[model samples]
Target: MYIEPSYIFLVVPAILLTMYAQSKVNTTFNKYLRVASISGYTGAEAARAILHSAGIYDVQVEMIPGQLTDHYDPRSKTLRLSSTVYNSHSIAAIGVAAHEVGHAIQHNKGYMFLTIRNTIVPVVNIGSQMAMPLIVLGLIFSSFLVNLGILLFSGIVLFQLITLPVEFNASRRAISILENEGFLAANEIGPAKKVLSAAALTYVASAAVAIANLLHLITVFGGRRDD
Candidate 1:
């Protein structure tokens, strides 16, 4: 297998930015870790409350192990939060939990971007896993496989790009609900915003990294002129 120094140049900046985004999330979360909501609701309770307010009773709130493993599963109709978020009453925990609930709400409402993302998931997974091996084999054997591999990588990048808007909209909904419903008090909004915004930056950084990797691959291998 061939590696390109250009790959480092392309991917390093995105890696650095992703690290920065992760740091920001840790800082913001730690800053608000002790700060509880005025309503004194744990993150799991907050999710339930927000879902009820949104008239979404069908979604189940459940706990799983690990840190920041929170996510909403559309198929299972379940919202799973990390142990920290599931039981903690901290602003950071509540913010994260609410964000996942926003995803549940999106699924319930047939959110367009989410619908698109979900529809493409199986293909994207297959494409992403297939890209590198196909590219490597194409380099060694069949030129026809090269362009196909690049296209597969591009699909992954497209999926990441679509993910950005979905995540931003979820954060928007979470913040709006927290603020409007008084789960976040006037003075506490900044920390919650910082936490969610920091988390959003991580997604942005992930998309950026995917794009950077795709560009680097294209630059190195995309110039083949014959099959």
Candidate 2:
């Protein structure tokens, strides 16, 4: 039950940033959600238009129930829009929808970072799920397990690091598409960009938290070994 100073110095700030990021995204999205786009295209229509414009006709746009649960399924070539986004003609909806289409475009073109991120997804998944448990058990049992767990946890950090560019690229693409494609008016573009930017902050925050946790683990456990 030994507490590491690094936990307070590293993990706490990361956690706070994550909370702020989450709150910012929600507030920004909701604020723009009420402002309907001048183009009158729903989120699903915007996604489809962006895909088609990218010459990616194979990706299907589907509506799913949830708030901010939108995602692109690269394997199935499907872009799923959340309930809040699917039928909404708001600037926030179009920006979020276009962002998902950016992923589709990345998939279609085999964007290098996205490809690399997808490639190790299975391993990262397993590593993330088992890392904490392994670490906890190792504290009572074996240093070897502790080391192995830290190695596994490192994959999570790596994944998040790779994800930074992917998410930022998508947001940039979203903003460009919204502006160039006339999805949002000149004045509305700023708001749309704000929505996407806020969403991107969440990814940054997540990466920070992952790195902090990894550092906390290494520092705490490494100190234990030295003793």
Candidate 3:
């Protein structure tokens, strides 16, 4: 297989940014994880309180194992918090909990971006799985396959792009809820913001990587149609 120099040029920087984003989130989370919030609300309590404040009593808050694995399941209407965030009263924990709750709030409010993201998730999953194999086979066989594969892979890139505003909005909502609800002290809010901001960087890096990969594919295989 011939490697394109453009692949390295286009993709390597995004990969490096991804590595940096992961490191930053981990480091920032850990740093804030040790700083207990003055509110003294465990992550679970903080999440529940915020949900109740928003009149979202139907959503269940539950604990799950792992670090940085917290998420909101809109279908189940459940917010699953990781062990790190579920039990800890640290500023990082509360911020993360609030962020996941923000997603629940979005679901409740019918946020347009979140709705679009959820609707396309199934299509994106199929596209992501089939894209690479189609692209590779196209290289060996038909131009039609190449074009089809690129189209499928383009969905993945589109999904990533759509995800950015969703994540950013959640983080912003988390900050606002945390401040308004007094989940964190005036001094502690800054540290919580740092944690959420670091996490948001990871999402930005992911979108960058997806865009870079899409560009690489277009540059390398886009013109392979049979003449």
Among these predicted structures, which one has the highest TM-score?
3
Report lDDT per candidate.
0.91, 0.91, 0.94
TM-score of 2: 0.96
Model 1: colliding residue pairs? none
- Which candidate, 1 or 3, has the higher lDDT? 3
Residue-pair clashes per candidate: 0, 0, 0
Residue-by-residue lDDT tens digits, candidate 3, 1-227: 97788778989999999999999999999999999989999999999999999999999999999999999999999999999999998999999999999999999999999999999999999999999999899888898899899999999999999999999999999999899878888898899899999999999999999999999999988978776
RMSD vs true structure, all candidates: 1.7, 1.7, 1.1
Q: What is the lDDT for 129 in model 3?
A: 94
The alpha-carbon deviation from the true structure for residue 161 of candidate 3, after best TM-score superposition, in angstroms, is 0.8
- Candidate 2 deviant stretches above 4 angstroms: 223-227
TM-score of each: 0.95, 0.96, 0.97
Q: Model 2, residue 58: what's the lDDT?
A: 90
Reference-based lDDT, residue 116, model 3: 96
Q: Write the per-residue lDDT of candidate 1 for residues 35-144, one digit (tens) a residue.
A: 87787889999999999999999999999998878999999999999998999999999999899999999999999999999999998999979999999998988777
